[model samples]
Target: MQPSHRYTRLTAIALGIAGVISFGSAGATGFQIRENSVKNQGRAFAGSATGQDDASVVSNNPAAMVNLDTTTIRTDVTLIDLTAKFKGGGRSGAGTPLTGGNGGDPGDATPVPAMSIVVPLHGAFEKLTLGAQLSAPFGLKTEYDSTWVGRYNAIESEVKTIDLTLSAAVKITDRFSVGAGFVYERAEATLTNAVDFGSGICANPQTRPLCLTPNPTAAAFGPQKNDGLAKVKGDDTGIGWILGFQWKPTDALSIGYSHRSEIDHDLAGNITFTKPGNVAAVFAAGGVTTYNNGPGGAALTTPSTDTVSVTYAFNDQFRMMFDAQQTDWHSLQSVDIKRANGNLITSEKFEWDDTMMYALGAEYDFSDSFTLRGGVAKDESPTNDTHRTPRLPDNDRMLYSVGLTWNANEHLSVDAAYTRITIDSPDVDVVSSSSSTLVGKFKGHADLFGIAAQYKF
Candidate 1:
């Protein structure tokens, strides 16, 4: 087979595999990271300063650890259910006619799992508090069935990430405190999908002649079927830091602020392709069969970013929190491919931009043992019309949530919350080098559910 043919087949297989690993099996929304204190949720994530109960406070603001008054150990676990539905155009030829079809299998659900722990240290230190934490703050998965209309575009993707943090808080005065921490994070991803070039383009008279070459295999197999799967795997790690402060102006009021730095991760993975017997038969007859172990894998990396937040309290009856976050998505502009032989295959450019997210929440204390919370937030999408792919058909989204905290006793507390998210389909256009016409007008939507628990020592 010609180099171009080998390249095309390999590309399809790689994309299919990456699609399955990164999106097909992965949830639509990446992993989620929320502040630790039950009171922080009421302000919509505003608790960078006033967090006192759970380890999440280490991520929100380490200074708040000084308020615990005791060597406290806390842990929280959350479970999320996500549903994504696709709508709009289906499979189509380059120039003839277009059809509306759905991608992915029916009744697919993505589950998100998260856990965190915070520990405070004492003994030799009278004014210092030490803490540690572990949790997943970012990642996502999206996948469709093989028969779906958009199968040629994407199939499935699964991505996961985790972070570990160590921190120290010090009381500078009777009412002032400060804290800082070192952060280490790790991430992994897998994607898979099928590539359909034969039926998609070879059947069209106008496009067929241009993509086909004289082949004995095509005659033996009675025509070739351009269908195959590709898979990509990757992993990487990085380091960052955090800083925060807290002030208690009076016995009845307190304020806090904190910032967590972003850490960059570089993922290294391999891509593989498998061809069916029928397709290989066609290539064999045409004397056009060729295969490389697989395309040289690439190194994928996403930039680290920062979040800042504040919290305020009035007596023990009421509290409010506000937060803002920035993500350096601009780093995703391209995926560069480098071969072990020191050859540069090609680069996939994705023109994404930096985004900001904001939220607010409030809490009401009904009694010494009971607290109620509610909040709202807005999240931004990282893809644009030109770069959008089936693996992550996302858009700006809005969230609303409510929860309750029950203090089982002085050291044990249980917290539960539910949130609903909604996003409108983004307008996009799809095209391929092997086809004659361009495809357009795709849309979809998704929903989410979550729950969590905490214990303090």
Candidate 2:
């Protein structure tokens, strides 16, 4: 092989390895997780920013902490089951048929847990309340068969985040309250994909001539004849802030608003390459053994959000709640990966748009010990077909939820809820810079079960 040919192939390998690290699918529309509060989930989060019955307000809306009256602790866990099936075909950069079966279901089942505590002070600090919360705000996981037709696009993709918040609220007046919080968030990701060594060598003009050599061994390294694998893992930490206000003009109605600042992360990690015997021999002949492992980094930003909610009681036995939320996802325009020395490796474009979510909920008091809850929500997707990726197959969806709060005793209450999400089939036709393409249609849905226990002292 010529020197220029080796350089071209090495560059292609670098791009494939770096581009695979993606914060992937399954959650609220666009890689955002919304199962932090089971009580809120029971009502499809309709009045999450205003309802103050549980310690979850520490994270949902700090201003609601003023209504906790006493010390409270809440713990919740939600199980999420997702089904993602793809039907499609793809081709190598050299325009050769990529041979393999459609990838099997890449869906996953995961558990999300959350906990919070709130304490109201008395005496000199009578109007002040303090709280703390731990939750997973954004997460994703999707794995596909290594031998799938789209293996060159993705194999395994996962991202997880943990957030700890410290909040405080003060009652400004008998009918008004204000609050703020500081959030410490950490994010981690791991991704893998098949590396088409054959396409990398045969697609480059400088190397194509060698691929046509008379020797059969020289011709064997062409489209799908030889393949390798690449994997990358990384983690980062960031800080953000939250602010909120609550007002009650009448004894039966309350309104609330909350905002969370965006967090920025610079993920530092390493990429590893695994090559088959034939592929390694070719690279070794070119004196490129060091390309097997190296350090890299990527920049990511968690979007900011604003929410407005209202809670109203019509009579002693019936109540209604509504909410509207907006997320600034447009800040994330692309994913650019860089070497440890600050050299650009590759770029993945997202071009996501800001999105809006709305929900409506109702509650009926079946008895003093039981309250039934149900809600419906409409959530929008930020991705467009032109920029969609197999790592994150998503679209607009509808959510339905039903649950109940059981007052086990004066100081303890248990909440259980079930939620279902139906997503519109999203189509994908992505062509990487290397000229490889992944064309397909995805069918997806999710089921969630949540339970929470809150205690007051």
Candidate number achieving the greatest TM-score relative to the actual structure: 2
What is the C-alpha local distance difference test score of each model?
0.58, 0.82
Candidate 1 stretches with Cα past 4 Å from truth are: 3-43, 90-101, 104-111, 197-224, 247-257, 281-291, 294-296, 432-448
Error of 1 at 113 (Å): 3.8
Error of 2 at 147 (Å): 1.0
The best candidate in terms of lDDT: 2
Q: Write the per-residue lDDT of candidate 2 for residues 247-342, one digit (tens) a residue.
A: 999989999999999999988777788888877876777665445687877788889999999999999899899999998999878877677888
* Over 4 Å off, model 2: 1-25, 213-218
Candidate 2 global CA lDDT score: 0.82
lDDT of 1 by residue, 58-164 (tens): 66678877767665555554343445566655333333343325664432454444444545455777788877777666666566676565655666666666778
Error of 1 at 409 (Å): 0.7
